[model samples]
Target: MPGSPPNAPCSMRASICALTCWCSDDTRPIRSATPRSSMRSGRARSSRPRPRSPRKNGSPRPGPHASRPRASRSTARTGPGRSKSGSPAGPCGSIRSSPPRSGPRNGRAGDCQSPARGYPRGMSAPVAVALEPCSTGENPLWHAGENALYWTDIPAGKLFRFDPADGIYRKVYEGEPVGGFTVQADGSLLLFRVSDFARFDPATGSLSILRTFRDEGMQRFNDVMADPEGRVFAGTIGTDDRGGGLYRVDTDGTVTRLFRGTRVSNGMGFTPDLRRMYWTDSTAKTISVFEYDRATGSLANPAIVHAAGPADGTPDGMVVDAEGNLWSARWDGHAILKIAPDGTVLERHAFPVAKVSALCFAGPDLDQFYVTTAGGGRPESQPLDGALFHLATGTRGPDRFRSRILL
Candidate 1:
């Protein structure tokens, strides 16, 4: 834990475990392992090699995705097209992959590499979206109620809706930099816009300010989710790297502060039965879980779910599949990570772009995944910088969490 810093990629094996950073395709493994602590100071001590399962042909397992050719890390392009500068357009916008990052997730790590690589072996591939670049695309939610997808652009103050049924996407609303939101049981939407909880009506195209935390004026809403009982929860982030917190908004228009001291609150999701909750703190590079009392609507027994180093990229938005695995968007890591309930990373799906913001399951069976990314957290000046991405993970996700419109 001491060696792992709070903002760098974990060492090589750690990166493999915690980040599952394959060179090109998510299915392929790295050709060789690197020494830990060589890339940076305060790195973790070396550990024994992990036991890999036998390959299909009974040959010694080749490196990850041995079927594919490796790409130059400097090239930076992973998907279909590349820019003149060699940086592929991220799913969100024109963000180029910077030099490889070095930092710890949650400021720590110890013997967590093997299981972190991916459990039960199959990696999910994310399809890069082809859309105009956005300023800072973050949270994405699938509206099963309307059979549409909704997402927000934090910097652009824009909200988007995509109808996969017809392959048409529209910019439905623009607000004061919304960070995250959830749908209610009554078909209204709850959002964390600016410094408070607000309601948005898709039918009338109007927004109503419902609750505020002025003390957190500098903080904006980031990640949001809902419980099975229809309780809404969202995370907030302070501008300029200050701090962030998590809050809960009930059906009766009550806002409750649940947790604080988080740095860049990111992904969040509830367990299948709604008895547990999980969330991410991006800057901290850690995902934490809590036990929820369904009847009382209270959280207890907090625990660490997963923590990634800077190399693994920061965790952003997340969604839970019917199998109970958490698929998270990785910012700066160029991958979408799937982790088992026991904190073991099940798979790492490479994204052509370096940023993966949020993901949701769409389609009639909830099997298709629609992910949103940004262009390196900046305005897009390049081609295909911020595009809507699609992936067929062949897994079904939970039901859509719709907000109960008080209006």
Candidate 2:
């Protein structure tokens, strides 16, 4: 990247500021962060082709909708009283520093250097998968057949898919706030919205309702996942007095309620072996595990494995990795928690902004992590709070189970 432009675009700059880089030289004790409420997570790799220009979010300056970042001491601005030279605005609006960066950079921009300090220096910084943040980004899914990533902005009622190959993305649906969705065995998307389910054709952008609820008002599919047998376990954000419920939607169209006591049903995932199912309840601040029966599609022996105390952030969306570990997003916590199968807090990847809503593994090899966040539509949200981000975590993830619900 020797000839790379002096002014990196907003995507690269945004990735830098939010990066919590680690290194070998500096040895500092990791301080304990008091856990609190939370929710989700990015992409750059050498194996892929170079990215195209950042046209959608390449604005060097902050727009009326984007949050303003603080200027770097070495940044020069073009306006009247500013120096008029240096890099562009980064995440949340931070200006790029004029000084040269040293070390090995993980992504395209330059040498690897942490925007701040502390932690083993990783090889790369988290990449901004989507510069345009969401107002409730959740449910990231990697479609190997299409070689792309898909996710939703719940409040905005928009669905988007991104191609890692060229750094290009397009909005696929815009009529409803999709709480969760799964790629069908045939490759179409089965969208679970507020009160109904839709079959979405990504290729043509055409969608048709699959099912409609009669009395489940406000009982949206908050989050869900397909079981190993093409069945889906859908959790809901039920009405005030009723509380959220977890239901099973089978291929035959018969629905069964498995559990019915969560305040806000959030994320769900299967254990690597498919023996256990993990569920998150944001309002209850807990990640519970249940005995999963793939043959019967029933859940039993439910137990609270990881309960987030006031200090620990509320667990939002979650997924199981290839290693049998759980990676969960913390709402308002500003970090993603990597939890062990036994529910131990293994590691925490911090974010620059709050409202980290959800994440998933994407990329051809399934080694990259794509994250989503919320609060993008709010005037008080942080710069990158609503943006979709990614990182090349040296870990592979399990394949997402496909839903085969008959229409």
> Taking the candidates one at a time, how many backbone clashes does each contain?
41, 30
Candidate 2 local lDDT, 6-74, one digit each (tens): 122222222323322222233232223444323322344458555455557765544446776754322
* Candidate No. with top lDDT: 2
lDDT of 1 by residue, 15-68 (tens): 111111222323432212332442566767669667898988898877755687
Q: How many backbone clashes does candidate 1 have?
A: 41
**lDDT accuracy of residue 191 in candidate 1:** 72
RMSD of candidates 1 onward, in order: 14.4, 14.3
List the candidate 1 regions with Cα displacement exceeding 4 Å: 1-125, 216-218, 239-242, 376-382, 405-407
Off by over 4 Å in 2: 1-124, 214-218
Model 1 TM? 0.68
Candidate 1 at 367: error in angstroms?
Answer: 0.7
